[model samples]
Target chain A: MTEHPGADVVIEAQNLDLTFETNDGPVHALKDVSLTIDKGEFVSFIGPSGCGKTTFLRCIAALEQPTGGSLSVNGMTPDEARRNRAYGYVFQAAGLYPWRTIARNIKLPLEIMGYSRSEQEERVNNVLQLVDLEGFGGKYPWQLSGGMQQRASIARALAFDADILLMDEPFGALDEIVRDHLNEQLLALWARTEKTIGFVTHSIPEAVYLSTKIVVMSPRPGRITDVIDSPLPKERPLDIRDTPEFIEVAHRVREGLRAGHSE
Target chain B: MKQVLAVLTVVAVIIAFWYAASVPMNIRGVLVEAERAGEVVDPPKAADRRQIDEFELILDNPFAIDDTWEQERPRLPAPHQVAEELWDTTVEKKITSKRSLVYHAWVTLSATLLGFAFGTGLGILLAVGIVHSKVMDMSVMPWAIVSQTIPIIALAPMIIVVLYSVGVQGIIPKAVISAYLSFFPVVVGMVKGLRSPDMMQLDLLRTYGASKAQGFWKLRLPASMPYLFASLKIGIAASLVGAIVGELPTGAVAGLGARLLAGSYYGQTVQIWSALFGAAILAACLVGLLGLIERAVLKRMGMA
Candidate 1:
């Protein structure tokens, strides 16, 4: 996650700050945070619950306004980028509209973008196959397992083929086995799509395994405590978790998280 | 099937109670009328003029049960009399006849449907306003609540009078009252339904850069279907009641309410009971239609 001199910058944050004014007082959620994500880079933000990892991701997606400083997505304001459909966001929960079938849920963005009916169908089928949920298009989200539902949510985000993916705790709710399986599948998906990813999670192993860059953040006046450039290679297998290099990256992420908590 | 059986059992028990209660309620009237008709006009002979309590006369009468069921001006009509009256008016009489229950029910039904449509549209519009704007939520919602506090019974006459003065007569005034009674439930239910999507869901839509109109059509409106149908059920029943109440103050001799008024004036308890049953049946049919539509729509939407 060292800055690649020639790599195109997809997302940039410069002295970004977001403070929420509560009834008690002003709660500084993000203070003077700055980061740059290059094209095709998978960046993971790891920290405690109150840390502004999710907040920062939301700010990038234009779901939340930064109280101060400048943040840009695709060299434009977040709001403008959002309007341009620069990114696909996968939330912590599947957040599928229960009223719609899996195929219809995937087609939602395409429908909003006013794609042709045939194009929407083709994209839905493609994304469903991409997520390994081809036949599940007709089924409802409740009929699927939690892992499958999350995958469907991912498919929904991938439906319109955006350049960037912002995933907030997409696999945090899954058990370890499903998490591992999904992690491998996610890496494969990322390699195939080559989209810039901004992932938020609390698990050190997940961050270490999936990310080229890991951002460790602190709570209270939420700030970035450490930004580790992972030295592990890009082609990660499920068994790589047992290797020494993977363990070393995970240890660094853990130490960084601990340092954030201690501050 | 089990729910139907339970409902049928309750209906049977109620009919049994109604039959039993009608005997007591109609007996005093029957006894007085019979005594007047059979007034011992001829002076009783010494053997027949025994001292007895006033209750002893009714107790001694063997045909009191038959008389109670057949009284022309009964205080409370027997169940069979009410049933016969309903069947005769609804089936034997022509549907277009003024005396027919079907004709009167249609009159009331038209008003109920018109008012229900108006209320539902108004409620949805207001709910959208309340959800999207702080000003409407703070200002209009309180007034909507306060509007319900004024009893429909007290307000119906004034609404009729005011409408009559402005040359708005008959169905319009009744429909207005029906709308007044029905709108509150729709507003409350729809406001809740429009806001039903959780923070994650809203944020997900925002991340997609969905406009307010798009968000409403895709998320809010579909999400509110169940709540809207539930409110419509309540609202339809209220609308029917409003229509009947609307008929009462206007002195119209057409709808079921007019039947009730005429029955009361002429002391025809059976007619009054028939009109009441007619109104009840109309409300049930309206609500049942809504339920069917709800099931079809919700199932089609994959929510059921």
Candidate 2:
């Protein structure tokens, strides 16, 4: 059983090491990685490309087993937790099936999880409403804009009622204007759902905008260098990032990344 | 309009050549009958006013009899003669008559459908096995290709004999032979289709933490429909060939193949031509039916 949120830890890792045995030689993907994510807390992992942030995300999702180390999600192993439908994952790309309409795709998890027909329909409608895509349920994935596709993917994950969201570069494929709009909408959703999110990205501002705590990672060694807590208020929007308080936290995250670069 | 006229002209020239080629005098014949042990195996039948061979055209001079001695070339038979014969053999006499195309066609159709179903089922099952297991990928796939390369005619006699000795008779043996030859395309096509989900789509499923079976059912199967249907078209054609070959080896009592055998023995050129056309039409109709089913199912799945 997963320990409650107030029990002080929902995710904990100790001395996590991952290695890949390829033809070239032994490639170290992650080393001495350790972290914690409190329940209902929003955290973003940002670093240079090939920094093993995705590896770490996948390790937590049980898609990849670490070469060595102990990792736990709400006390259970990632695999066990996953079997229990514990986390909802959003990928770097929208990854929507072109053949399926928005409503049907959102119903995918519900089908696998064996929801009743009425419940499946209800949850799909609810999530579509949540993502501001209520009227667009019947539209095919290709018919929608890139941002809309991403939102549909989010709604798919959100529809399943999982408390944790593992978003790997969810808005990485969208343009700046759309990205900004989605970031604000995401923050609003986060505030409403209070999901414990693990977001991976390369954009510094994006990490700062959504994160309660920003984990700065560096490549080569591929380990976390710093975890900077945000001082900004919980109620945030695009304008919040322009404020003095937000800039200060952003500056600290930058320093943490710089420190990672130096060390 | 000009294109239509050109096409008609081409058809007319072809027909004229065909008429000249069928002139009786040009035909070479030796005995055209066989007898063994003083038994009449196939006796020469009574010749009508016209013989099919090249000499009959000059002898009869049916065309321009009273006029210019210009005989209209003797036709192989007007197409209507063959059609009337076919209708008489199939619909008029039905299966009870000795010269029934209906009985023979039924025999062939039954085998083709049985074999097609078996082959389709086997192919789908093998494709699933390949998609799921590394052992099958390494083992079953290589052998399947080699199996196709062996001349099916050589293989048919062996298949028929072996199955018959084992007490497997009638349609099942023939169908199994058909299936054996027909399944390879479906297996290859479906395997490719199942593997069609690339790294990006897989990564998406991974992010969702979908189980292996879930990934297959939700993504792989749906993605494979177009490939499966395309393969079905080829697979169905091969199945018909397999069934006909199966019938040939068995010295089939009733089938289009049997008609060919009977026609050859009796020197009935029209019978051979008509039976071949019937088989061709049957194969086309079966393929068309599968296509209709494919379109309907894919549309329902929203994959059209």
Candidate 3:
């Protein structure tokens, strides 16, 4: 892992720490967090609430500033990378503006980045199709169902065509059936786009099913306890989770979480 | 259609009550006049004759009910009497004539519209400042609340006197008063609206590297649309009231407030009622126009 091919590191964090100063005192959100994500990798940060998985994702997006250690994205500081439009972020909630139609909502980042009218229209159309939300562009966020709204939000994140997609529990609020369907679609999306994806989730099965590299974390001064690289091939299907190898990886993630808790 | 019918029903009930009230309110003066004219030879015992006398008056003069509704100086003028006066002073008279209600209305409306514009602009600026700066939020917000506590009636005379002494008389002083009343709602609404975006939404913008200006224009301002319209409705009504109040102290010969003062001095209850209704109708029109604009804007934004 230490000798991972040079120049392939898309995200490198060393001893990253973030302590939030509150009225009660200081709460350590992340401590001694270190990881290296390679290009085109689908990495999942799996932990319980307060484990700082979201916090870490926020840090990579430059939404939260790390207090200690070094973190870089695309060989630039997180802030610099953010300024360069290095990634697209999806929040837990859909967060689509009710005042804007679905098409306009998806076109927001592109508009901010000063894309021309024709380009914005073209990209909006492309991403809407990519997310299978065609012909719903003129509808408002409230007009759509929860799953559809989440897909529209995903379409929004994809509209700008960023090389990295950072999602903070994007499907956490959906029902199990909807979530499974979205997970499969996400895998297919990653296969087509080949974008570096950083996904945060609390579901064990979801993390194992979707991620190539799973970072298991623990709370009480949050830190990564295990980094598991899957032995499964890139060509994955919904049935892959039923394989013995998949069970072994899931077991390892569970043991890592338990061991961290015991210590 | 249903809403219009409901409003008509309410108006009809109010008119009926007004006519009934005018009979009792004007009967005393009418009876005194009758006694002075020797029409009632000898006054009967007050308690015994009350019902009988009232019946007799109605029987003797079939026009008594009509007379009650058409008195020149009634204590409570009947709705038809007010409506007649409104018609004579608005449609019968030329629009440019000094005696016309339309001319007076225009004077008051001009002040109201100008004051509303100034107040809304200033309020939005202050709200943006208050939202972005903690110092402004802590300092200006409390002072704004304190300002509203001082009655406009008390403030109006003083403001008029001060402005007159400084040679800033006429429409400007009245507009200043209107502005003073209208700005508070705008400030409160805009402040709330500007801060309406949730933490996740703000963070989402931040992740996109959006500047503060971009955040305000795209997110905060758009989110504030419903709030701004709500406050504008309140602000415009307050401004009309302010303009009328401003006219009272100045003793102007034009505008709705001056008409009210003249009616009171001459004991012309019908005229006063007409002016009051005129102001009400004017306020309704302003607020109704704003509602239409709100619908159009919100619908375009996909928020309706």
Q: What is the C-alpha RMSD of each candidate to the true structure, in Å?
A: 3.4, 7.2, 3.1
Please give each candidate's TM-score: 0.93, 0.80, 0.92
Go through the candidates in order and give each one's DockQ. 0.78, 0.28, 0.82
Cα lDDT tens digits for candidate 1, A112-204: 888999999999999998989989999988899999999999999999899999999999899999999999999999999999999999888
Report residue A40 deviation for candidate 1 (angstroms): 1.5
lDDT of 1 at A71: 94
Q: Which stretches of candidate 2 lie over 4 Å from their true place?
A: A1-7, A97-101, A138-143, A241-263, B1-103, B198-216
List model 3 lDDT by residue over B78-139, tens digit each.
Answer: 77788899999999999999999999999999999989998999899999999999999999
Q: Per-residue alpha-carbon lDDT of model 3 for A213-255, expressed as tens digits?
A: 9999999899999999988888888999999999999999999
lDDT of 2 by residue, B1-304 (tens): 9999999999888766655544442222211211122322122332532244434533433331222111222225434446666788778885966678777777888998889889989999999999999999999999999999999989988998998999998888779878987799899999999999888788667655678999998999999988999999999889888888887778767778778777766677678767877788888998899899999988777677
Model 1 segments beyond 4 Å from truth?
A: A1-4, B1-5, B39-63
Question: Which of candidates 2 and 3 reaches a greater lDDT?
Answer: 3
- What shift in Å separates residue B119 of candidate 2 from its native position after superposition? 1.6
Q: Please report how far candidate 2 places residue B225 from its true position, in Å.
A: 2.5
Worst ten in a row by lDDT for model 1 chain A: A1-10
Ranking by lDDT: 3, 1, 2
How would the candidate models be sorted by TM-score, starting from the highest? 1, 3, 2
Worst 10 residues of 3 chain A by lDDT: A1-10
Better of 2 and 3 by DockQ: 3
User: Of the candidates numbered 1 and 2, which has the greater TM-score value?
Assistant: 1
